[model samples]
Target: MKYLILGAGPAGLTFANMLLSSGEDDFLVIEKENSAGGLCRSCMVDGSPFDIGGGHFLDVRDPDVTKFVFGFLHEDEWDRYERDSRIDLYGDIIGSPIEANIWQLPDKKQERFLHHIAEAGCNRGEPMPEKFTDWIEWKLGLAIAEDYMLPYNRKMFGEDLDSLGTYWLEKLPNVSYEETKRSCAEHRPYGTQPGHAKFFYPHSYGYGEAFIRMASALGDRIHYNEPVFSIDYDNRIVNGKYSADKIIVTIPWTGVREHIGLPGKLTDSIGKLRYSSVVIEYVPENMDTKAHWIYYPDPKLSYHRILVRHNFCPGSKGYWTETNLTRFDEDKAAEEGRTYFVNEYAYPLNTIGKQELMKELLEYTASKNIYGLGRWGEWQHYNSDVVIRRAMELSIN
Candidate 1:
């Protein structure tokens, strides 16, 4: 094979398709699982489709990226909807970013949150804190931070929220005292919409259906149930089987250490990579909620968020809960008898030195015929569109 791809996820499969589209086909896509689709894989349960890797929808932010993603499925096969995401705040349901939607809350509650926003550090011209925990307080004030941001992030990123850096916050919606107050005064949404504000989903299948179609298009070019047990990077050989001129690794760097042959220093550094894990559990929901997904910030709840699958997916009156792997209850999950999928490397953490470390490792690998791509490969918490666009760009280069 001229090229060897080490995963069948969004990054790997997209790269494979791009290669084929360019009239180049001497490549093999290897997936450790018996099937393709990687973490985005979906399964059927009593006529309902479950996204085992958690809720992944085609983001409509980038026209080019969305166009490329829409190519796999026909127009009639997909459905688009404006995002109606909600937040559960201490028994009260309101729009997300309590700062902007404070008007929806009770009069007293609205007045209190407005006061909190007024006293926020961002309004006082205070410097942003370095830690995620303190930054939350500084960015949105102590009230909203404690009420929603802090506890919700604790459920999402685990107990020591301080360990996380503030770099990733740039991607999230930024709240300011002026916009927030104006929003509350006028009862309108402020700032930008979160990802999937307007998105697409498959009509009859889960979000993974398009990737499955992409995999099917590749035919024999994809190798299933094949793990790269050992890689001879010196010779560009994989498991003593096939040799390729270049290899693209889309798996987590932490998991790839044992399978790769690298210097002790490089391998040890790879082991130090930090990431978060999540367990997705699907359950039946007879309630017909208009919201596509709801965020739970209460520390009492195990799940940080739940996707109303019935709203987006067809033929199913169910929802899926996402919990941090540390808090997931196996017994309860088994009792639910619903679908449960665990991904050990869910969100790559933006630690103190993660950027520098990834830069060094990627530079080293590129020098050798091995390259890292996508979320795990690049250790970036990128959405599907960004991952696919990166893959497409790499294929062209």
Candidate 2:
């Protein structure tokens, strides 16, 4: 059966690759941009290549997806490194996975967190919180939630924390009062805590290089710069008469709703979805620092994160001098006494209303045989591995 895949990002590309590798070659992949990679694409600025949507580390623990994406990387092409990530909070560099590094907090804040832990431990089997606030209080207690979690989330999501659904709370690591106090008293860093401590990255090219290789494998099967403006669901076709036995759409759900001429019921709900726009700045190789990625939870900074491309691959230094990927105009950057290229993306914001809207969109699209996968398409937050794995599952089923 012929298949038409929309949006040549990771999800669409993964689905195409899975089907083609299975000896099913009658599928077409369409991308609106000049090339693929979507949010994961990198650009050159002043000879340095900067990931427009921040650097992506390939930390997926799933072997099937890992092998599928990086299988072609020669020994020298990939680098296996332990994660050296950190968070900047209140003039202090706290080890990443902030929950475990309570010692980084000032002594007063530490004592407050300790008290919160005590309270939380006593309140077992309480009714689940209704809002993100309640969940934070229940999980991390009042102190950490008010001091760190609340502010950090507000900066990241660009929305009130209470509006967020509590589904994501389970992903966070929880520590009891005694555990936190003991760890702090021992002066242990948060990095020693469990989950996602070790991650891998490509050694030579940026992470986008992996996707570029995948696209190369498909060769002529993939079509770039083909923005699908419309889909005719009444006739079960796309772009007004491009026929396919099956359609796999990986574009943002917003695009899908617009293409299919969704009715008022669906369109109204879909409109509630929210997203955060990013501005990436790629500086000169001379500006390279020790950080792989820096998280800016403080609201003062316009950008939420800053990443150093050279940190991922030493060879990337050469590219830093040739072009500007950070989207900052050379003359403008000079005027502002800055020297980096910047690129940005509007990330999907997972507000409760938007979450519900996304669920409706996914269910509606799935019912029509037009599977929606990936972060933007499904309106769910996901890393690269999650997108690839989900697409593989969808393609196989």
Q: How well is each residue in 178-207 modelled by candidate 1, as lDDT tens digits?
A: 776777788887776666879888899888
Clashing pairs for predicted structure model 1, backbone only: none
Instruction: Output the lDDT of residue 13, model 2.
Output: 85
* Candidate 2 residue-pair clash tally: 28
TM-score for each prediction? 0.95, 0.86
Candidate number with greatest lDDT: 1
Estimate, for each residue in 136-230, the C-alpha lDDT of model 2 and write its tens digit: 87887777676667766776665566667888667666656677778789888543444345566766566677777777878887778777877
Instruction: Please report, in order, the local distance difference test score of every candidate based on alpha carbons.
Output: 0.84, 0.69
All-Cα superposition RMSD per candidate: 1.7, 4.1
